[model samples]
Target: MKRRDALKNIGAAIGYSAVIPTAFNLLQSCTSEKEKWTPLFFSVDEAIVIKNLVDLILPKTDKTPGALDVNVPQFIDLYAYNVYVEEKLEEYRLSIDSILKALPIPETGAIDLKYEDYDNLLKKYLKASKEEKQQYISDKNITYEALINLRNQSVWAYKTSKTIGKDVLAYDPIPAVQKGCISVEEATGGKAWSL
Candidate 1:
């Protein structure tokens, strides 16, 4: 082979070898399990309840995807673990423990709550007969623990839902959609009309 041709082939082979592994890694990274993209901050037990809680907040619907579909549970865990300060995480832990204790259980072990269990418990306290809840508050009195638990869980779910809408969905600010898209003009009656 000509010296020039041999050198060219060597260069091509080197380039191909370098590119192949990177391409393969990228592909594998894309197809890897959901856990790969998700950074888990929660303990295995905490993750179980959090997963259930997120699913309850945003159940899979025919029209739109659910929380788990977008990995909201993982999002929450990541936020709580990485974003939240130690004080906040401590607060979250206490709140979660309270909720776990409030639910019907044989023992107060750090057991994971199934989706059904979390849903049933939340519905019982937040949805079922307002009168019953009020009465329980008036008679037995909802403990501070219960109240805190309810508050934390509700906040967590709400935050997770909002994040999904803003971050996961392809929502963008005005003028960000496309260049030279027809600008809607406001008509006299405050209705939108195309310019």
Candidate 2:
């Protein structure tokens, strides 16, 4: 074989060798389970409840997708497991358990609150006075603090997600001009700017 022809064949072989593994990897990733969101910190049941709660907290609207769509529950699970200290982790777990227990769970082990009902329940809590909140904590064993923590986490996860920050919210990939005095409405049409 000619030297040039031999080198050409070798180059083709090297190119194919490099491309084959990457192709297989891409195909494998595509074929893998799409719904692989197991929680590290939460039990399967707890994870399910968290998922339901987060979805309820940030339901899908005409403007943007809900927490479930943004994988906020998964993010919460990871954040609780990885970010929290031992004391905080225990507190989070107990709070989650308390909140789950407060909800009406059916024989199927799922919370029975409809989306609207859950939203109303959240609103009720949000609107409650300090005395009412204390009464609720004493009576129902579900603290407002726990609910607030959950809300904060959900909001953090939702706002920080790439989908929400980059797509749903106002994201400028390349900011050529920086105006400090611009109103939010003037800047990004009332949507919060991406960090």
Candidate 3:
């Protein structure tokens, strides 16, 4: 090959190599930090609130797992992302923020209260050792009621979303009952319970 042509070809090859890596890096950055639990129509912050709301509303008790464990937050996120109207998502955001703003947060955005701020108040209730959380909730009229409203919206959103067929199906119902049948057929003088 001619020297000039060889140099031109080599330079083109080098340019192409450089372009490829830059392109790959750009793509990688874009692809990283993707929606882990199928982003609901909610923003990143909204999704976190959805999670916290679920944790408070359907708290994990000895009888059953809580909303968080059942992937309800993810379910809510995916629902908001795909099925909820813009107005509804905004409402959920506003409602959550209204409650959060009522809490003692630092000017810098960190919460002012410790993890166990309401020791005998919330955590003890959570731990199943005391019922103070319920009383505190009734007294303060916060978290529980907020969660109830939030959970209703979230669950409705999830049931309406495409993710429901998968997420709800994946959820563990007590006794592992199927579509319309009871798991156990007690023929021994039973009242034919459908619960």
lDDT of the candidates, in the order given: 0.51, 0.68, 0.46
What is the alpha-carbon RMSD of candidate 2 to the true structure?
14.0
lDDT of 3 by residue, 1-195 (tens): 864344344435675343333322222222223345545365554455455555665666774455555566665444334333457556666656655655454554432344433233234333442365567566754454454566575454333332333333333335553455434333212232221
Better of 2 and 3 by TM-score: 2
Q: Report the C-alpha lDDT of model 2 over 1-195, residue by residue, as the tens digit.
A: 864344344435675344333322222222123278666889977877777778778899997888777777776776555445567668788888876676666677654546664565577776788888788777764546677788887887677666777898899989899789979999899987875
On TM-score, the leading prediction is 2
Clashing pairs in 3: 40-77, 40-80, 40-81, 41-80, 41-81
- Give candidate 1's TM-score: 0.51
Question: For each candidate, C-alpha RMSD in Å?
Answer: 15.7, 14.0, 17.8
TM-scores, all candidates, are 0.51, 0.70, 0.42
Residue runs of model 2 more than 4 Å from their true location after superposition: 1-34, 111-124, 129-131, 134-142
lDDT of 2 at 109: 69
Candidate ranking (TM-score, best to worst): 2, 1, 3
TM-score head-to-head 1 vs 2, winner: 2
* Clash list (residue pairs), candidate 2: none
Model 3 residue runs over 4 Å out of place are: 1-40, 107-146, 153-195
Report the number of clashing residue pairs per model.
Answer: 0, 0, 5
